[model samples]
Target: MPLHSLQRLSPTVLLGLWRLSETPADLWPLLPRAEAYRALLPATADGKRQAQWLGGRVLIHRLLAEAAPAVAAAVQVHNDPTGRPWLDGPGAELTVSLSHSGAWVAAILARGGRAGVDIEEIRDKAQRLASKFLAPAEWAAAQAACTTAAEASTHYTLLWSAKETLYKLAAQRGIIFKTQLLLGEFEPRAAGHIPATLVLSDFETRHCICYSQPSPGYVLTYCHESPA
Candidate 1:
């Protein structure tokens, strides 16, 4: 019930966010133990990890419960070999992704396709390491585009979070972030909304990524990918 935001992207696809104000003990009752997610509940999990795991389950339940009780009751979340969390059981009809950053956690559920979501705390790092995750051309573009250190940092965070979302969505092993996942460079837009694109396999695959400042000092992005 702590879902801070929910966007009905489509009839069966939903994007949900939880502020993580509840502790693991508080969330335990809401999230009943199930085989799919039971073992994932780490005994040593602190608040951050607890929210990271529980937020996804709670969001799925609350989002589905909104439409119908039966629809909401089918969610079972488990991880694949890639360690990406997925829904199972009655929830198998949906493809879902979950991410947690700082005090916020995000989950995206698509009725007919896969979804990926990521969030990052904004800080200055681009000036120090843009070249690490970005290509030479992208680094040059970022330098030419951003006018200040603060702007450059936001650019770095956006690029980092964008690739992370794409990687999670792809769930493909052995792909390097800096080289395999390709993203174009653009000025970091602080106001309104800015949309970015991420490409892989030399244009064989494409995904649209949208950025939003869900809270001060944090960046959030989510993408919907169709299975190839």
Candidate 2:
């Protein structure tokens, strides 16, 4: 029952967040195919990894219950070789993405298109590592846009989270986060929409990413691709 928030982003999209208050034992029974999912856990999996994995599936089912009631209990989560999670069985058509950071896990589902999401616990590490994932100009712009250190911290956290969401949407490997995924310059705030572009060798795609501080010390970002 640690479902922190589930919101209908639009008629076709549903977003949910789960704050971990339960252990693997508590969450095992909440999942649909409990044993199957349990088998997916690696031998090295620790308590936190188990919780994040279980919490993510539980959160997905919670969202599915609202978006596709009849299929909620039947849909299962599977991951590709690249570790991108997808829905199988009755609700196979729903494009979904899942992410976790610290004690928070998030999921986003799109009924007829693709969706991606990420959550991060705000900390100083993001600011220190900004240059690795963000372009030089992007980092400079971020510094110029924010007025205070806290805002700058939040800004960098969001930039990292936004790139993570974009990577999920791409659903492929060999992407260099710093060079390939490009986030447009923006001022930081409580919540807002920002632009991002993914540059491939032969082509590029633009995306609108939504970001917010859903809880204290945490930042969440998600993006969607319209169904064809």
Candidate 3:
């Protein structure tokens, strides 16, 4: 479909979502440096992957339209050595994070710092793998708060999605999810903020990550960090 949702999370942060219904041909027209970005994709990429890839840029373009209309049609998405995305071209002052799951793609753009976004399709897998990502107490609290199997699935998926968003914001390699990046006490809701902490060797930083269920089976989480 078209741009699904776009919202200003803060004065300098914008979030956008796009559903993957269009083919690569359809999405290419929505981007500015379409041919250049296409060349950056792996030679082995299939049509679905290409579509998802372009869908993220398309979402970003839409977000820029809302936040920085002057450069919305000029800047292109580029990746650094670590595979983190940023804007390139005239007035390319924003950093971005892109993510796709199943048939949904999401992006976050921040003017003065880093941004991270994650969208996940709710499934039983998150519940099955919760122990590996959630702390012992976190898993227990989530399980106790869930009254039904479906509720547990949504809760676990949000935890994983929230941590993924935090990880993207960190941009530091070799961090473990269960111990280093942790979510504080909270039950899943249709939409709300979750308290989270990123534990470094000698210090820690906390964040209030925002999350929402854009559709029935999907959960979206995003956060932005200002430059230190």
Candidate 4:
């Protein structure tokens, strides 16, 4: 599939999602020449990994072309010490984040602030692994709030994706999701919005995060430093 979806979350922030339908041959011509993007692509030529990597760059290029030309031409997408993808170049001015799951790739582009985006398939692991990321109270609330098993599954994915999204945004060290990232008001749906809070360093400070479900099969969430 070509660019699956695009959203202007704010004047400075752009969100885009792409589902991979193109093979490695079709994507090679579009890949940026920068060596920085090399690691983003896997050694294996055929797989969701390569497709998602190409899809991410495609979305980044599309978003930049639509938003800013200078950023589009000179920008180099690279990873940080924490394995977080970011834009770096003389003309680069956007804070970016990328994620993929189950053949879907997601990207967030923002100016003047941080941005993080995550997409997770609504699989069965969330319910089983809830204890790894959620406190007892949060898990109880989520269970009570979900009306059905499907809803509960999505809720758990949302909870997991929400934290993953926040992790990309904060990009800090030694932050425990179970203890530091507290669950807030979550309105689960096939497609809807969610608000979350993150406590940093043993609850010394808290940051608010934003989330949304862009598609039915995946739970997508994003966060930034902006007030939005």
The number of the candidate with the highest TM-score is 2
Model 2 misplaced stretches (Cα beyond 4 Å): none
lDDT (tens digit, per residue) of candidate 4 on 123-194: 879988998999888888887888878887888988898888877877788888897777676565555555
CA lDDT, candidate 3, residue 128? 94
Looking at candidate 4, what is the lDDT of residue 15? 90
Error of 3 at 54 (Å): 0.8
Worst 10 residues of 3 by lDDT: 84-93
Q: lDDT for model 4, please.
A: 0.77
Local distance difference test, each candidate:
0.73, 0.88, 0.86, 0.77
Distance from true position, residue 107, model 2, in Å? Answer: 0.1
Error of 2 at 61 (Å): 1.0
Give the higher-TM-score candidate: 2 or 3. 2
> If scored against the real structure, what TM-score would every candidate get?
0.85, 0.93, 0.92, 0.88
Question: Model 2: which residue pairs collide?
Answer: none
Residue-wise C-alpha lDDT for candidate 2, range 48-158, written one tens digit per residue: 988888899999999999999999998889888888888889899789999998889999999887789999998878889987898988888888887888887888888
lDDT of 1 by residue, 73-180 (tens): 666677788778776666676677888877788888776666788888887764576667777776777778777877777777887888888887777787777777
lDDT of 1 at 67: 45
